[model samples]
Target: MLMLLWNVLKKFDLLSLDNEEEIISHLRRLSDDENYLLRDIIQAYQILQDCFQNITYQHLQLVKTVVEYSNVIEMMKKSDLYSTYGRRRFQELRDNLTTQFQLQE
Candidate 1:
């Protein structure tokens, strides 16, 4: 669903073609997940796209932030130590840092 929306947006020049593959790649793994989280992430992406339109500098940074954080989260979830409280704390810190970067622009 997210990929289709992204492709539609890209085809219509509403989104960048350069980042289209990267966005789809980032989203491909969760394509089959029967959960709402992926949809929420795409919604967040769209929100950022709308809210930060015309701010290319910040927009790229936003995409990078989300992709990197999502990758980390995915790795943590698949790792043996993911259930540990310390990993959760680390994720919280990482999220805070990402938020700080987003807030800066």
Candidate 2:
């Protein structure tokens, strides 16, 4: 049950929320509804892999990679790494990461 709640929090992007009352309020708001989204973390991972082109998203190895690359993307956004060259490099890196995640047929 606790894991289920954790998955919901992660899926809803509410994990960073530290206010207990607010968290309870949100839980109450979602009570008995949208049960479809309350999945375990692995299922969420599979959903991510399915939605993307080639991301294999291995259960054992993905957490750090995602966190690190995601930070890079966020930082780059604030840094206006959106210049033509930077954007191209970022895309190339993105595509390369996709290839790295691809599953062999």
Candidate 3:
């Protein structure tokens, strides 16, 4: 899941993209939802990836990434990343999510 998200981010150049606010807003909406499923997490990740294609400020992007990453973590807790790819993938995914979130700052 993390690798997929990272690839999408890299392929889409979401780091320098604009629409940070929109991405953040969408993330907030997803995160706030009580029934957030893995599918929603994937979709939110895609929306964020799409936003990164635009030329946005690094700070805003970081902020958005943090929220999105938080949602990923939360969802992982609910859905169990353990079943996804064992501990190694989970760690890598967590690290990547943190890296992307921090890159915004």
Cα lDDT of model 2 by residue, 8-62, tens digit:
3454354334554554454444544556454543554543333333433473245
Error of 2 at 28 (Å): 34
Instruction: Name the better of 2 and 3 by lDDT.
Output: 3
What candidate 2 gets wrong by more than 4 Å, as runs, is 1-74, 77-80, 103-105
Worst 10 residues of 1 by lDDT: 4-13
Q: Please estimate how well model 2 matches the true structure, expressed as its whole-model Cα lDDT.
A: 0.52
Order of models, best lDDT first: 3, 1, 2
Instruction: Give the 10-residue window scoring lowest on summed lDDT in candidate 2.
Output: 47-56
Candidate 1 per-residue C-alpha lDDT over 1-105 given as tens digits, one digit per residue, 9 for 90 to 100: 555544434434454566756555554544545564867678647743663476577755665465547667567676644567768787888899999999999
- Scored against the true structure, residue 14 in model 2 reaches a CA lDDT of 41
Which clashing pairs does model 2 show? none
Candidate 1 lDDT (Cα, 0 to 1): 0.59
lDDT digits (tens) for residues 8-97 of candidate 3: 444445644466566556566665676888888887767765555455588556645755677676776776667755567778978999
**Model 1: clashing residue pairs?**
none
Q: How far off is residue 50 in model 2, in Å?
A: 45
- Candidate 3, TM-score vs. the true structure? 0.27
